[model samples]
Target chain A: MSSTDMLQVISKNGKAKRGAEPNLPKKTLLAMYEAMMQTRLLDERMINLQRQGRIGFYVPSTGEEAAQVGSCMALDDTDWLFPSYRVPGLFLMRGVDIQHLVANCFGNEADLCKGRQMPVHYAFAEHKLVSISSPIGTHIIHATGLAMAQKLKKDKGISAVYFGDGGTSSNDFHSGLNFAGVAKAPVLFICTNNQWAISVPIEKQTASETIAIKGEAYGMPGVRVDGNDVLAVYDACKKAADRARKGDGPTLIELMTYRRGPHSSSDDPTRYRGNQADEWLDRDPILRFRKYLEVADMWSEKQETELIERLKAGINAEVKKGEAAGQPSLETMFTDVYANVPPHLREQYENLVRDEGTGHEPDPDAAFPL
Target chain B: MSSITMVQAVNDALREEMRGDDDVVVLGEDVGINGGVFRCTADLIDEFGEERVIDTPLSESGIIGAAVGMALYGLKPVPEIQFSDFIWPAFDQITSEMAKMRYRSGGQFTCPMVVRTPYGGGIRGGHYHSQSPEAYFTHTPGLVVVIPSDPYDAKGLLKAAIRCEDPVIFLEPKRIYRAPKMDVPDDDDYVVEIGKAAVRREGTDFTITAYGAMVAVALEACEKAAEQGWSGEVVDLRTLLPLDEDAIIQSVTKTGRLVTLQEATKFCGFSSEISAIVAEKAIDVLEAPVKRVSGFDVPFPYTLEHVYMPHADRVLKAIEGVMTY
Candidate 1:
């Protein structure tokens, strides 16, 4: 497809175009709609928790649910995902435990990261989901590297990495694409062009006509898809993944979407841009997908109310469990810095315990031999 | 055992590791067919083929970032950064991502990779090609910093680093890459333990602490001090972080006087950390104040490299000054 031409399956009014619907199983389509809805609800609850001072901070992907969920659903179980901080749907769709994810946000004792990282920087190795960092576009090369390793091992798995429009300007974006192109690494570069990166618009992030077109210079096919249409995104991503698995090299996909919320709890988008009009609001991915499901006789107002009620109660219980988990043990600060704790860290830990009047005795064997 | 140069020893370590472990792969600019700029990875591509021995694009961040991903995916990647001076481009990947991978992921993910780079000055490489950038990596936690003074230690330490569970910044003293041949073992199982210091000489007057290329300079200075009727000890710190404080303290307590030498600048260099450790742990047994002989606080000059780098005479002066004080 041309860079300027967008591949859209579902229309803005929630009607599928003629012969454009993806051939996914009914169960898969229902699952995709549920995941998108769950993501939207979770984001709203997390933001409310942040505002209530129950959590420190959160990044809400309000309007970009289809981009995150659809692209993640296209991958096989063995494939790897390197996600941006905004894409919490990727974690949920990958089958991460909701309680674990909530605990990570609370940085509680049950948190897998041991409260070491900031909230939303979730890491689940079982799902083949790489950890998230705050740096933009850095993980792009990492996805390429993982894909290269898979290719070398003759493995059937490919890697997919996500970034925003602003990430297009990062040095690693160029490096990752150029290197992956040269190596013929089986990976997909997915950019969720959500119109605004913080306060900067996409026009200011790049001078190119579109982010997808930039892939042409790196020797990769560029495709643009409707981010509000889950079926379209799934079709594009699955096709790209199949090409990568077949050793045909990488593909660049631009998911045309919009961020309908603030950058974070701390950001004030009102200071920079005017209110988003109703035209943009009507294109919400969850709304469009819900319409599509209803048109297919798959969903109704009764089912929608029940799903929302069940999700709300379930999310609330997980949040309560996370809150009641308590803070991570003080000693967790020193652990995981290395495979074995060196003498220096041991001494420091001892000093901290003594200073805190915890009366904790030093374990002679705890320190690794120097 | 066979006598070999430091570069040859490095090559032997990579070859053995790759042959032993199918997961160990080597990648960098000119590392495949060209066998690296210093020939440290020579003939690796011939044995491992193009899949394992990769010649990547000339992007430092790309090389290191890709290595991080490879390591995360269960491959032991040894990425060479042509020179330590050019390593700044990948500094974010090393410090932010690779070093923090295990901690940030709560031990679910780990980056077990070694970043091999040639460092330090003596070959008139000027500012760009020669620099002692160990202080940067040493200051960052969750990273193992290792340097070797000779071929035997280079091969052994590199092999150990490859097997390490944490990320390692293996700085090779490029100036001594072709130094006098030393007997490096050919056995595949031979490996040196990390976080250990080797006492090269025994002395009663003072102790000289050094690592990498400075170990040879310290040894030369020790001989000069002995010729002047003064005894000095030489300690080679194989690992910079998680320092072998016991070895340092033991040597300092015996000799009473201390002299720290490094090729990096004196201000906030690795030598400062050494001096501080001695002051904190073994201050009561000191005969005189610890002295540091290091490069001046100036950029490495091409024509004046001999003046920029610390020599035996400078180290000898520090030893005499500390002993007399």
Candidate 2:
């Protein structure tokens, strides 16, 4: 497919375009829908928790569920996922326990990051999901490196990296794609072109006609897909993964979607943007997928209600458990910095432990007066 | 044991490590085929093949950034930055990502990689080629900053760094990469433990604290001081992050006079940290205040590099100043 042409499986009215749908198993299709629903519920609850001062901060991927979950479904379980902050759906699709995700949000003892990282920066090594960092496009080169290693070891699995349109302009984007193209690394560069990066529009982010087309400059094929349609995302990603596995080098797949909410709980879209575009609102990924599911007799109003209630209750219970678990151990601060603590750090830890609870504690309510 | 240059020692270390572990890979610009600009990776491509000794693009950030990923994937990647002066481009990856990977991931993910770069002035490489940026890495926690003075320590320290569970910044003193040959063990098992300081010269009148190329200069200054009826102790601090505070304190307490030397700029250099450690720990035993002889607080000069580097003369002056004080 041409870079300018966007692949679409499901039409605006929820009807599948003739012969365009992927041949996914019935169980996999239902699992995709469930994961999308779970992601939406979790995002809404987390944002509400942030608003209620129960959590410090959260980044919601409300509108791009299809892009995140569908692309994730296309990968092998052994394939490494280097994701940005806005791909919580990808985490859920990969079977990350909701309670552990909530623990990360609460920065609790059970959190995989042991409260060291900021909220929503999740990492699960067992699932081959690399830890998320705040810096943009850095993981892109890492994915290329891992993919190169895979190629050297003749591993069947490839690596996939997820970033946004704004990330396309970052230096690492150029470095990663160029290196991957040269090495013919078995990797997929998935750019979720959500139009806005914080406050900067895509128009200002780059002068290129399309982010995907920029892949040609690095000797890679570029494809664009209707990110609102899960089938299209899955199809494009699956094709890209196949090519990468065949040693055809990396492919840049741009998932054309929109950020339907504020960048994060701390951001206010109303200040920088006039309003949510009606065109994008109509093309909401979850609603479009739900419509497609309903049209296929795979879902119904009764099932939707039950699913929403079940997800809400499950998420709320996880949030309650995370909150009750409290913060990580104070000793954890000195641990994990090194495999074995140095003498100086050991002394510092001893001093802190000796003076524990002696310092004045700040009021939690007054800490974040937002 | 074989007497060899620092660069040869580094090559031996890499060859030995690669031969021992299939996961130990070396990647950098011109590291393969061309055998690296300094020949530090000479004949490695032929031995380990292009896959292990990779010649990467000229992007320093990509070299380090990709190495971080390789390390995350259970490969001990030793990525060369070519020169420490060019390391700023990959500073974000080195500091924010590589160093903090294990800690930020709560030990779920770790970057057990070594970033090897040639550092320090006296190569006449001017501004872009010569620099002593060990202070920057030393300031960063979670990074084991090691700088070896001679060939013996280069191979041993690099092996220790490669075996380290954490990320290590192995800064090679390019000024002495070819000079100061030492009998380094041919065995792969030889490793100089990290965070321990080696006392090169024992004395009682004063103490000279230094590392990397400065260690040689400190030793020379110690010899000159000995000729002038002053016994000066020289401590080679192989690792800077988990600093050899015990060695520094012991030497300072014994001599009661301290002089710190480094090729880095005088302001906020690793020498300042050494002086601070001595002040904090061995102040009561100190007869004179700690004196630091370091590069001037200016951009590393090209034509004036000799004036920029701390030689034995300047170190001797500092030693005499601290002795008289």
Number of the top lDDT candidate:
1
TM-score of each: 0.98, 0.98
lDDT (Cα, tens digit) per residue for candidate 1, span A1-370: 6977898999877899999887988888878877888888899998898887778788999999999889998999999999887888898888987888899988888999988877889989999999999998999999999999999999989999999998889989998999999999999999999988899998898889988898899999999998878888998999999999999999999999988888888888878887863457878888888888888888899999999999889899999898877677777889989999999999999988878866444333321211
Worst 10 residues of 2 chain B by lDDT: B273-282
Which runs of model 2 end up more than 4 angstroms from their true locations?
Answer: A357-370
The C-alpha local distance difference test score for the whole of candidate 2 amounts to 0.90
Restricted to chain B, the TM-score per model reads 0.99, 0.99
Cand. 2: chain B TM-score: 0.99
DockQ of 1: 0.88
Off by over 4 Å in 1: A359-370
- All models, DockQ values? 0.88, 0.87
Q: What's the true lDDT of residue A76 in model 2? A: 93
Candidate 2 lDDT over residue span A63-154, tens digit each? 89999999999999989999998898888999888888999988877998998877889999989999999998999999999998898889
Candidate 1 chain B: minimum summed lDDT over ten consecutive residues — where? B316-325
* Alpha-carbon shift of residue B246 in model 2 (angstroms): 0.6
